[model samples]
Target: MSVTAAKGFTAAGIVAGIKENGNPDLALVVNTGPRRAAAGVFTSNRVKAAPVLWSEQVLKSGRLSAVILNSGGANACTGPKGFQDTHATAEKVADVLGVGAGEVAVCSTGLIGVLLPMDKLLPGVETAVGQLSEHGGEKAAIAIKTTDTVHKTSVVTKDGWTVGGMAKGAGMLAPGLATMLVVLTTDADLDSDALDKALRAATKVTFDRVDSDGCMSTNDTVLLLASGASEVTPEYAEFAEAVRAVCDDLGQQLIRDAEGASKDIKVEVINAATEDDAVEVGRSIARNNLLKCAIHGEDPNWGRVLSAIGTTSAAFEPDRLNVAINGVWVCKNGGVGEDRDKVDMRYREVHIVADLAAGSETATIWTNDLTADYVHENSAYSS
Candidate 1:
């Protein structure tokens, strides 16, 4: 259960020949709501997809009745015709769902700069809208996968309401926000202002901290829609916490399933002067290609960790720094502490802790180890 795990949402996934392999590539999520309030976050990338541009404008009214998503064409760098295709898509879904085109949000993923097969995609909306059901969340999640080995979904329930979401992204895993495409739904009685506040606060730490492959996508989009079907108005802090929990879970799943990764690495930076310092140091370590390769090889390379941290502008004295791999304090006071031979690196999950020895701020950035399979998959991805 994803979006449909919450109330007032119906979803469907279908194949409309958008992919040559005949796999599912189109999805529709409709909100049969008492409220149409919504909030969204898109890629900070300068180059964005046609759908991203379309959805950005549509969400200005803080209302979205449905979201139409497709995988197999990014519709980026295709200029005016690409935007026209995205517009035509929203219009089709709006007509079917009996909502204005401006009230529908659209998202797409796949190869960059390639135009979508509108002939297949436009007609596919009809099929998806027809099949929409409250039980269709899982199918909708599956239809949006690109390089992911499995579909991702998360849900959290409280007294009388629930928040649920689905995310799809394996390659281009790093993001100011990642989607490749994420849709979250909640039945709680919240307005657009509240939803926007919570969505930004939730993503700031969750999606923003995930850095697999260190590459952002052109089609990234995360949307939160409120149906107010549960009729429960949770305290703002409580509701925001619930949203954060789902985002954090989904972010971990993305790291676990990073394209062709052999290890899930968690880089935790501690005792920094500020939270921003901790995050900067942690992200630097997480995105270090050399460090990722070392992790993939199961080589407890503490030197790479220090080297990675040093490159960041975060507050840290070289001599006061400390490093640990797994549970072994391999480096202390900037020198070798425990015996390097005593560290074990056979586990699929590796944890690296860096103590900045500055103050009491900390952050964790989840990432993945680089492997030959990653190169292989990406090299042939557009084929």
Candidate 2:
């Protein structure tokens, strides 16, 4: 289940000499399409990466014929030269694929404030183009890794068409789209407007709700390209649901593979005055380092959860709040309800439910427990 799983796409991943360790660091994904309608969502970060800036411009036309990705350097904060390198790379891909430079999108990941070796990247693009294949999606997915231990891909097939995608992220995972570079492809007949509507709606609850390290990246990007290869236009609602399912699956995969995380925590906030209130409360709870540490130690410290909730401006009465850990009501009516020891935390998955008791709206945020491994990994990441 990958980008090439959809019709009208070819992909390749190859070693580009960008990574000193000699892993595959370059990827090319091309839409051999009858229609190149596209939509994109990028990092809201003010300090955007060079590739992100370039891709944003390319996406303004709502068309993309190809995407080139690299995983050894973020190409961010390197000033005009960095952007020049990104442009040169896109131009190379376009040259090889016989498409306009503006029809190419670029994505890069890895350390920030460094320039990519254009000498290697431009040549790598030519090599990647030579190897493009329908079976290359898996390789392309594997090529876009930074700290990720495993590559992630998801696919959902409707009655007549399919939506497939690949995502790369393992750390710096937070709201504002998370530290991820995601490319989704669909053969369903849809215009850029429809794709944008479905992508934004799906990501709002999927990628936007994932808060692993409470940090955002300058290079986060998600793009959806439609080829209209299947020549099938399902109902808008049905198409949107398929996109949501794939994005949700990929989001869960990111949480599961979060750096140094032993427990995947799902924070669900319910009965809020509005959806915004619910999301705010859930993010507050998920981003609470104290609660994450407690979860790491298998301690069902509901107080941390309550304190996190209290910090939010959401509509909730202190006396009417309720909290549950692993299906045990640890806090009911804002007071201790059940034995904390009754909460089980032996498994890798932990569920926390926060009831605001203000309305019927609800939201869920996915995160992971903080641990020593995470600290160690990130502390020495630059090395």
Residue 200, model 1, lDDT: 98
Error of 2 at 201 (Å): 0.5
Tens-digit lDDT track of model 2 for 262-369: 999999999999999999999999989999999999999999999999998999899999999999999999998999889989999999999999999999999999
Ten contiguous residues minimizing lDDT sum, candidate 1 = 170-179
Please provide, for model 1 over 285-333, each residue's C-alpha lDDT reduced to its tens digit, 9 standing for 90 to 100: 9989998999988899999999999899999899999999998999999
Q: List the RMSD of every prediction in angstroms.
A: 1.8, 1.7
**Residue 83 C-alpha lDDT in model 2:** 94
Candidate 1 displacement at residue 336 in angstroms: 0.8
Clashes of each: 0, 0
The best candidate by lDDT is 2
